[model samples]
Target: MTKGRPGENPAERPRAAVMEDVAELAGVSAMTVSRVLNAPEKVRPETRARVLAAVRELDYRPNSAARVLVTGRSGVLGVVCFDTTLYGPASTLFGIEQAARDSDYLVSIASLPALNRRWITRGIDRLRSQSVDGVIVVAPHESAAEGLRNLPPGLPVVDVGGGADLPVPVAAVDQFAGAARATRHLLSLGHRTVWHLSGPPNWIDASGRVAGWRSVLEAEGREIPEPLVGDWTAHSGYEIGKRLAREPGVTAIFVANDHMAMGVLRALRETGRRVPEDVSVVGFDDVPEAAYFWPPLTTVRQNFGEVGRQAFQLLLDRIAGMEGEARRMVEPELVVRESTGVSP
Candidate 1:
């Protein structure tokens, strides 16, 4: 027996000894010992028990880094996101993390700043250097599409909402369709015409929504009024709402997102306009708080969790050399609430 070090318990030894000695005593290979540690269910119960007993006897602890080096698989996936604080991107990240954990994989996130070309390029380069098995990019801005043009070939990527035209596999909620549905619902309520509050024009989703709202109204032969723009914020929505409140003959409105709709609600209330009474409102992105709005909100629901799950799976498939269409679109659902009603 090895003597203990000075002021240390002489009986204890480093954990690495346990792993090596266990493999030797159990008459198994080191790779077998690793499999037993990393994937217990894959090893036969009898062999696994023997490894466990030897491990206990030798006090062995396997090193994860060594295992990763030998296997060439870190079991990690990298996610690049823009606007980490945004409701949709944040929720998608949570979903991706949870799904990765469930699949016995690790997720690492890198938040891109403002979805600019330089930020996206640098983020992707950083993730590549980390040896991530694949990458999922939450590219909600138009600049992301431009960035995609510069990505190195054959790097597995799944884009979320970069644009309608994608060079790699993509998973996105159908913003255009959702916006059209919201507009149609308001029109069906007997509103002569509907006004729009749009998000920042540079975002792909915002552009799709704006186009959808415009196309629907134009198809119905309704007069299309100039849409007010917001920065996907409640404050911007409120500002636009204030302007709408002062305008005459504005009976119905569709705001780009629920957060902004909250601002619209505040403005309408301050201006003495009752929702669904003097004015009706509908919004996109049925965020959790939408239901709790004063009169509740009528909005479009984008299933961001589903988007993340599908995007990750698509990336994995791509990494495995699977071939399929590069773009995929998810449909959104229109949620009806108390905020919209028949026009007077």
Candidate 2:
């Protein structure tokens, strides 16, 4: 036996708690605790609650090493995505971690600085080396989604914000509908013609928003102006906004995200153009800061939390050998704020 540390009293001290201790405290068998931890759906709600309560009270955590040795499985999920500093991707990552925790699993994450076929493969490989049961990729850009198509066979995978008609399962926001709604709302406010500032062409979300905006303009018989393109940044928006501010006929503009909207607002202010008075501005991804923007921002709200949870569920289902139509789309909502008003 390993020698105990100095001053340690192994004989008098209670041993670290085990699953059996938790089961006894909850008045259930050890197998029940196992089921609750592994296949919670199989256990009745009441029993699962009781076991979980006991687990919490006892501060019980399964012995991952022993469990892995016996089961040849790691009770962990991997989340692979780009930077988490951006609001949307960050929120999705948070949601995925929360969902994994609630389901009694740990999460390993690989955040790439830039996404490419080689980097994505390396990230997946890193997680695979750790034996994560499955992975969820937040592949908004085309390149990231393309890398996913070449993943090794038998790896359970899901994607959040994947490209259109992706072969793998995906959970994404209905960007098209949300964009249409935002544009339609502006048209309802009597904007004769609405201009758009689109996100980068490489992102599916960006393309979907552009398509939706285009469809609305076409339907209303309005002439479409060339949309300004942004790399989904405030700086890009500022540059585009400066040009639009110089145009007297540009009365209404829809930006692809709130970050860009802020830039546009600033650019308009600098150019002596008034929001709602001279030009009505709308943005997408009703981020937390949207409501706090100067004059606030009317925008589309994609429930990234829900999308992440759905991706987690889909991945889990695949890991359990169930598959088909795992692609799920969460609808986006248009939130009205002070930034948009009767088009001048």
Top candidate when judged by TM-score against the true structure: 1
Q: What is the lDDT of residue 156 in candidate 2?
A: 92
Residue pairs clashing in model 1 are 4-10, 18-60, 19-60
Error of 1 at 226 (Å): 1.4
Residue 114 alpha-carbon offset, candidate 1, angstroms: 2.8
Per-model C-alpha lDDT, please? 0.86, 0.89
lDDT (Cα) of model 1: 0.86
lDDT of 2 by residue, 114-223 (tens): 87778877888899888889998886988876788788888898889987667689999998999999999999999998899999988889999999999999999999
Off by over 4 Å in 1: 1-13, 16-19, 34-45, 55-62
lDDT of 1 by residue, 65-162 (tens): 76667776667888899877899998888878878888878888888756688888888889878777788989788888778777877678889876
